[model samples]
Target: MGKYAQLVIGPAGCGKSTYCNHLYEHCQAIKRSVHVVNLDPAAEAFQYPVSLDIRDLVCLEDVMEELGLGPNGGLLYCMEYLEDNLHEWLGEELEGYGDEDYLVFDCPGQIELYNHLSVFRSFVDFLKNDGWSVCVVYCLDAHFVTDVAKFMAGALQALAAMVKLELPHVNILTKVDLMEDKNHLDEFLFPDPELLLHQLAASTGPRFRQLNRAMGGLLEEFSLVSFLPLDITDEDSIADILGQIDMAIQYGEDAEPRIRDELEDGGDDDDDDGGGDGGDDI
Candidate 1:
């Protein structure tokens, strides 16, 4: 019996915190117990309940003050510090769980951690070795993906994360609730590659025409790149996204089957008593 973890990761300001908060509420509404672990040492505040916090081990402000580092530099330093002290820091934080507990780790917003760096991957491997099933939830801002070229960039970044992680990965388009007109979103949501290439080439000022076509061809070759639209305000949309993640993690497959209780009362025999009928039959 191993615990389950959903590693919520994404670019900066891409609604990772909002998604974690929404997931916490969603699980609570469904009567499912879930714990959110804050892994961002630089995170100032969060809206959800944090079961485990990295700041308990190392705080970014303290790191910045002591090491004379800025916000970004302090974040990188904190992550490196955690890596050096993983056994004492993250190991202790993950202790005392009964294996069935669900944990959602709200990771840092730095894309490098997921792309070229192995820090997060090492953490993931650590969890897996400790008997926790892990799933990577890569979120991209939907607002930034309104245009064809931007959408392509988003897709490529997501692909890079997927390749780097090499685990069960899910791409999510976030902040959809903020869309003024969803029609533009629909085009990118279910885009046809050829049509997108034509649109990108036509929209760009001829300098990027060749580049757009080449990029579009690469996207067509790899069809696994797709996004699950996320609207934090919509419960149904959240459920749908969770459903996909649940499948990836096989969330409830090990649970006991639900049984219906049998009613022990409520039948009446008006014609005769149950015991009397046996003697009166003759």
Candidate 2:
């Protein structure tokens, strides 16, 4: 049996940490065991109690102060440092969890890590090699739907991560509750290429519209980009998103046999209790 994990990733302010926090609360409410690993070394606060934090291994602030690097550079350095120490640090910490444990890794907001960088790819490889099933949970702000160009750009970003990670991917449109007109999401969720092209033509000049057409065609050709809306205020919405993730990684598939085993043992106990002394009573 392998442990399961979802790497929560997105641009800054896309609600990645909030999603993890809400998921932690929801799992606790339902009595489902889950652990949140803070992979963002620069993260200063969290709404949920972190089970494991990369900052404990390598803090971005410390790296910046010592290396004299800026925020983004410092963060990149910290991730690389963590990558270097994966076996000695993260591997040791992960050993504490059972095979059935489900881990949610709250990743840093740097899009470069998922799109082109090898750091995250190496980290994911380590987890998979260590007998863990992992998936990418790509988060995009729901506001991206309001603009045709922005929505296409977000989709391309998701596609980039999918291509780079090559793992089970679940794209989420976060903060849907903040959108005044939820109808705007419908077009992006189930996009009509023609409609998108028309919108692009209206928004951009002719030369740029040609570029939009090519971009839209590329997206259509791949046909792998779609998003599920996530409204944190709605428990059912959160549940539906979590269900999608669970299916992506096949999280609970192994538990069915264990459940059957328990039920069989219970049946034996029932048989012993009734068959021995109460056999004639009934």
Candidate 3:
């Protein structure tokens, strides 16, 4: 048996932390256990229970002061430092977790880490070697995907993470409730490439419209990525998103046996109490 985890990742202000927070709360509401690990060393606050914190190993402020690096540079350094110490520090941190435990690793908002960087890849490989099943949950802000160009860009970003991570990937369009016209998101959520191209032609200049056509064609040709809207405010929406993730990671299969065991044990106790305890009391 292996531990299951979702690496919650996205750009800054895309609601990665908020997604983790909501997922944590939803799990609690349903009486399911899901633990969160804050992988962002720069995180200063937490809204959910943290099982493991990267800040304990490396703090961005401390790194910046010691190395005299700027914010991004300091963050990159901290991630690399954490990567270097994965075997020693992370191994011990994960020791407390067991099979059937579901972990949500709330990652930093470094686009480089998700693509064009080996740090996160190496870390993910380490987790795999340690018998953990992992999935990548890539988030994009709903407000950012309003236009055709932005939709193409967001899709490509998701595709990039998929290509780089090489894990089970789930893309989420988050903060849907914050969108100016929530009803208008349907077109982007389940996009029509033809419609997108037409919109692109109308919106942008001629030179860029050609580029948009080329990129849009590439996206249509690949047809590998899509986004699920996440309001987070709606329980059904959260459950639907979680269902997709659970299916991708085969979580239901792992849970069935545990549920059966508990039910059987409960039945045995009920039978014992009714027959033996009742007669003894009489």
Per TM-score, the best of the predicted structures is 2
lDDT of 2: 0.90
Q: Model 2, range 17-46, lDDT digits (tens) per residue?
A: 999999999999999999999999999999
* lDDT of candidate model 1 versus the reference: 0.83
Per-model TM values vs. the true structure: 0.87, 0.92, 0.89
Q: Name the lDDT of candidate 3.
A: 0.88
Q: Compose the digit string of candidate 1's lDDT tens values, residues 64-162.
A: 999999988898888888777887777877787766799999999987888877788788888888888988998989986667777888888887888
lDDT of each: 0.83, 0.90, 0.88
Q: How are the candidates ranked when ordered by lDDT, highest leading?
A: 2, 3, 1
- Candidate 1: pairs in clash: none
Highest lDDT scorer: 2
CA shift of 280, model 1, Å: 35
Better of 1 and 3 by lDDT: 3
Model 3 TM-score (2 dp): 0.89
Local accuracy of candidate 3 as per-residue lDDT tens digits, 198-247: 98888888888768878788778877778899987799988999999988
- Give the winner by TM-score: 2 or 3: 2
**lDDT at 43, model 3:** 93
Q: In model 2, where do residues sit more than 4 Å from their true spots?
A: 261-282
